[model samples]
Target: MAANAPFTPPLALASLSGEADADWARAGAAYAGAAFLGGIALDADSRAAARELVARDRSEFLPDEPITFIDRELAALGDVPIQPAFNVRSATVEPVAEAARVCRDRDTLLEINAHCRQDELCAVGCGETLLRDRERLATYVERAAETGVTVGAKVRAEVPGVDLPVLARDLEAAGAAFVHVDAMDSEPVIADVADATDLFVIANNGVRDTETVREYVEYGADAVSVGRPSDNPTVLERVRAAVDREFGLEATR
Candidate 1:
């Protein structure tokens, strides 16, 4: 990512609020300076619990200072966005909505993640299974936006009967501001988003170098997300350099 390139969203966090407290330890690295750094895999129950567990220093499973380090750079890095991994079930459950509320009040971008494929989730009809329930998904999208938060959805390349392009459109109609397309497993990238029509798209998966980033942009992605690989710590530096260099070019223009 070039420094001048518009800021990309922080799509993944090193540590989830509840999944693995150890993951939070993965956050403080050389690349912790800026961007909306965050982790994922927090369920509704866990978020509430995590809030209750907030240490006196405001760190829970993670440190406030390091979190602050990333938040501080949000302005410098552009759009300090954070996506809380969510899987919606009932309006009453409203976990996704709760997460969005936090993001908006905190000035973070709230994204609904619909790409999980865990056997447990699928068996219970969540994650990708939700994609099959377009109407419900639409309602979920609407609910998130109504909270005054910028809405986004992360989706996988293929889902049983759902059409990706149509899903994109459905999401937009439901009030999504952005759509995250997961191109995991080195899957062949497909270009078919008539449904989303004109929503901002961010392609994730198998991304590391400048060329891969440019490829996604060429495919009409507004930006790309870098994750997991950054666990090496050195990879975080790569993202910093990539984002700075690209955005620098945009600045020159």
Candidate 2:
């Protein structure tokens, strides 16, 4: 939500929790220059709930320890503040509030994972399921905001029947600090979302280099994020240089 800063760094390292923990320490060091970094998305509820999600989708994985352990893993990133995204399967706001409190205590941001498409998560009315239930999602955001930590909602742009721009507006109205959109091949959606809300708009998906970074900026995104490509330092450097040259933005490193 630091959009007021002149020349905000256009590139950020997106969430890579499940697949990258083994290399997380090294990977975090490699992309330390990123303007923003997101920790792996985790289930913010009980282990039994996490296991149920995993059982439904073999690809879904959550840490075995308490959610606070995520704080320790993220601390390994050192100076690069991490916004830890969490997927909660609860019908109430207590879990969301607890996650937000953790982030607040850690002096970092908390992002609600409404962008994930895992089957098990969807079945439990979590993840993309929130997309269809905008009111409920807004309540969750509102609850998270009560913790006094910056709360962001991550959403996919391509979900059927859900208007991305309107959703962004609703989230902002609900006290969300920003809306992270997985633009997913549609740069204009970023434009629409940016136009609809005053909240910081973070563009995600298919970002590979400077051109893509500039493209999203031109489309009105406050910032752009890189996922898999951030695993390689050389690639991250190229994108960072591009952002600096194209937007006159300096890396915060």
Model 1, range 1-253, lDDT digits (tens) per residue? 1222223332233222233222322352334321223333245443343344453333333333323433333333333222322222222227567656655665655556566565444554455766787787777789889999777676788566878888888988888877767876533443465224677666677667666666665565656665556456566556545644543443531
**C-alpha lDDT of all candidate models, in order:** 0.52, 0.66
Cα displacement (angstroms), candidate 1, residue 245, comes to 5.5
lDDT of 2 at 174: 90
Name model 2 segments beyond 4 Å from true. Answer: 1-8, 20-26, 29-61, 78-92, 250-253
* Candidate 1 residue 94 C-alpha distance from true site, Å: 2.3
Error of 1 at 109 (Å): 1.7
TM-scores for the candidates: 0.65, 0.83
**TM-score winner:** 2
How far off is residue 228 in model 1, in Å? 1.2
